[model samples]
Target: MSTPDTVTVDGPGLRDDPSRPGPVDVPALLAHSRETVGPALRAAVARLDVSSREQAEYHLGWVEADGSPGRGGGKAVRPALALLSAAAAGAPAETGLAGAVAVELVHNFSLVHDDLMDGDRERRHRPTVWARWGAASAILCGDGLLTLATEVLLEDRSPHAAAAARLVAVTTRELIRGQAEDVAFERRADVGVDECLTMAAGKTGSLLATSAAIGAVLAGAPTAAVRGLSDYGMAVGMAFQLVDDLLGIWGDPAVTGKPVLSDLRSRKKSLPVTFAVQRGGAAGRELAAWLAHTGEQTDAELRAAADLVERGGGREWAGAEARRRMVAAERALAGAGLAAGPHAELLALGHHLIDREF
Candidate 1:
């Protein structure tokens, strides 16, 4: 668990310290979100068929491959965001439980498919579902999770359930479109910054936007508030992806759960790499030439590529862009009609996503 540079946890429970000024105790906030959402999530998973259930249980870190107690569940960022958005709309966090579980299911669905598509055999220090079982099981698990994400929302009795469900369907399409663009970019040498931003908006931003908006929609928030929350989530998501790109090239492998310079090794034209490629400096030219090589890249070669990305101004630009997006997120929330506490927490969480090395 990493803390943003702006928040602290020196108070009782979820309350902030009165002496210092910042967001509430975020660790506590997230823990509360996870606790609040866990039973519903588990109930949904329990409804799955045996094979799918086993894979979901393992992948969600609720149980080990051997069915023992374990933990690999992610940070619960989506769920926390959903719950906070509910509160922002003047409802209790539990009012957003369905949305929280739905977004989380969608997120895990994407992760299962991502690992298989990337041929990644490990995640959270465990064998990936495909590696442990087989590709068929992994595929089935992802399908089951995606189906459940919609069912969760539809099953809700709220008057807004239908609209929220529709948003989920639309967001999923956008997510897949983004994923398709990402896969296509992996093979092309001419990925531009604008298209990359567009891809990221879909791949990462849409789901997050839904997570922030669906809860409020379920609570029947006014349209302007919902739109502001959605915009805030999108800005935060974009900043999150930019920071993730930096981590891919320069973060500690132990912290990132990927090898050092993993993006460079795979020749991924991430935002930073795209910036470098478009800069057209000597370092950028060398990086472009090296990326054109379709053969395996050595560790030394990967290090040199990271160097080129930095020298070409990619690294600095990414950091600056992330900060810029965070600023935009703050602006988006100015008139959001959010509860003061939840609003502060939302801003804190967004900063946390970009500020941490992980």
Candidate 2:
């Protein structure tokens, strides 16, 4: 974990930090978010059919594949976003608890379905929901989560309840659209940069944007403040996905908890890969040929493909683009009118999102 006084990345966009007492402690914030959101998810799942409930619980890491107690989960970024956004809007963080749980449920809903669609056998170093519970159960579990996300919001009975639910629904639709495009891209050989960016914004950016905005809306923030939070989330979300794409090619398997070149192995059309192809250089040509092959690539071939991606400037371009997005995020956050504490925490969180190793 990075200390508040940690010397972070310095560039045109990222502001220098002297010391902070809030969002710099990412691990602590994540733990706090999980504590708030986890029980809500568990209770919601408990209301479902017994078998489906078990599957959902397993997927959520509340239990093992064999129904034993276990501990495993994501970094809780979405929940933290909701809580922080509420604080930024001058509301108590507890007021956003429902919003945070809804966002976490929706996020896990996407994960369950994505694993099935991608034929991914593992997630968080465990067998994926589909891999362990079968496709039917996995699909049901995902449906259950989506239902719970809306149900939690509807149960709130607050003035912004309907609006928040609407936001989540709209974002979920975009997510589905992005997933459709991603599947279609796998079958085509000519995916362009613009299309890839659109897909990324929908699949990854929309939920995160909504996550950051919902808390503000629930807190009855002014319209401009809510919009600012939304824009900040969108920018950070794009930057986050870009970093993820970079890590897919070059990150250590131990740190990422995945196989080497996992994205390449899956033939994912990640941002860096798109940039490499768009460059149309010798390295791009070489990479295009490797991408054309349908057979499973050897480890050596995967290494060569990664080399081509980096040599073609994909790595540098993505890093720069991410930093630019970070700058955009900072600008939007500045307009959110948050108190110093929330604003500083959000800035730190934004920097952490871009500068993380895994």
Candidate 3:
């Protein structure tokens, strides 16, 4: 197997590191997000009745299937990014925590709905909300989280509240469009590179961009700085998707918590597979035929298709593209004129996106 390139050093464990300085405090970021955002989410659910509160808690992974507290919630990366970006932009990081909470809630909301749509059974190494609570309950829970996210955005008394609302509106719409495109691509054979990129940007990139933009807006950053941060977010978002696509094909199922070749088994029109189809000749046709087949294929057939994608340069192409985007993200961060310390951390984050093994 061809070895993939390494991107950046991994962050510390899930707890904050007081000894560490600069942007390397992923543990600290994660801890802060959990402490702050976690409470806000719980309070949001508290306003509802006991049954609804239980459902919301369960979906947040804060409570068990029986509505008891659980251990396997998310890493809260989106909110951390928002708060970090705000801090880097010169505002008190705490000021942006609510925005972080809002983004993370919306993200979890999307994940719950996405799991339902994709018929996914597991998330964060546990049974998905839909799998545990059934589809109807999951859908309602997702709706509730989304509603709470809007409330959080509006609750912020900052002047940027209006802009944050606009960001949320645009991000939500883009997410729906991206999800629609993804579903449509599954049944179609003619998906192109540009189309896939567009879908990825909408589905994945929009939220990240909004998160960064929210930070800048809350920090009272200049318009140019906000635009730069948005660009940085977009580039990182693209890299994130490319890396995810790579993991879907080449990742160890044990670590990924999913079946190996899961995307291939489902015939997902991921970037590598789509690029292979567009660039590979007869081999590509064979792969497409396999995808079009209604019956399940043997393990060997799946391996052959994966081999075709690798041999056709799809994997390499995607990897290279991810690197290119990481570079672009770095340039954008530099242009944003953040302090050297935070800027370095953001740059490391860009590299980390492309380099993550999990």
Candidate 4:
């Protein structure tokens, strides 16, 4: 969602050299991800019945059995990170393809169940799997994907397979726990900023850490370097969630592909709103009154709530926090001592995440 920051680099830097080009093209990265992962996913889905498999493939934006292309695939950022990290760590990029695919499959599995639990009707501008096929079917499909992800990891015979397995298992549990905490926060009036950050780290950060760790492992990087990449991923992931919280309140529907004020309408305990509530002033009191009101909020009420969040300095605080995390991520990447180009790209990506408007 974020754009790249402009840097006045001397000679040889990404923006300075006319021949070196600018930031990585996200669409090209996505295309590479699809080329590497798509066939394997299709093969895994072949074990299912025609209807179930069709539905699963549709969710992935693959062709149905009838060979018609489906809709709504995502940007594949996780897999791209995995593959890029591998390359940055000195292995052939293709060496990490299996790990990339596995991580992405697990991510999609979680997303399917998450949409069901949240009763979200749409994803990637299309009806969610649960919305189209029913909760039972969606659950089964998600489970199947999870199983396949583990199988893919096993098939790769990674030297650090045990560690990768442990990471995924732990990440999955934390994901559930974070989601539960999020749901619980919706009913409570006193959600703390620290608690919200903890939930965000567990839910969004853990898997990203795993993605980078797995890539480093596959590349046979030293333990210290692997750990550094994991830490970098965690920091970047937190920054991403903070930016997402900002977008949930202020982003254009066209850019985010979601309705404006949707998080407010759902009464989500996002960082900005929670901070505003904790500030406890005129804005906080007005927000509390709105929360207690029996009726649903009109557009004006939602706008007022957003204004309260902004006035309370929640947005500013979150933006600063995201920037801080980006700095931490850059330090971690430097600690890993990876090649200059990929490190530059990763730093650019981190800046983009923190600075994005949508």
Top candidate by lDDT: 1
List ranges where model 1 is wrong by over 4 Å: 1-23
**Each candidate: RMSD to true structure?**
3.0, 4.4, 3.7, 3.5
Per-model TM-score, in order, reads 0.93, 0.92, 0.90, 0.89
lDDT of 2 by residue, 327-348 (tens): 8988998877875666666777
- How high a TM-score does candidate 3 get? 0.90
Using TM-score as the measure, which candidate wins? Answer: 1
Per-residue lDDT over 1-358 for candidate 4, one digit per residue giving the tens place of the 0 to 100 score: 2446543222122222324645564455456666776776678777766766777787887754356776547767777677767766867666677778778888888888889998989877678889988999899988887887777767776687656666677877887788898888778877888999999988899888877667778878888878888898899999989889988988888877668987787777788777777774778767766665655889898898889888877788888888788778878988997766556655655565566665
lDDT of 1: 0.86
lDDT of each residue in 250-338, candidate 3, tens digit only: 88898677688878887888998888888877767777777778878787878888998887778898889887888788788877877
Give each model's clash number.
0, 0, 3, 1
lDDT of 3 at 104: 83
Candidate 3 segments whose C-alpha is farther than 4 A from its true place = 1-23
Candidate 2 wrong stretches, greater than 4 Å:
1-23
Predicted structure 2: lDDT: 0.81
Local distance difference test scores for all models: 0.86, 0.81, 0.76, 0.75
- Per-residue error for 324 in candidate 3, Å, reads 0.7
Q: Flag clash pairs in model 1.
A: none
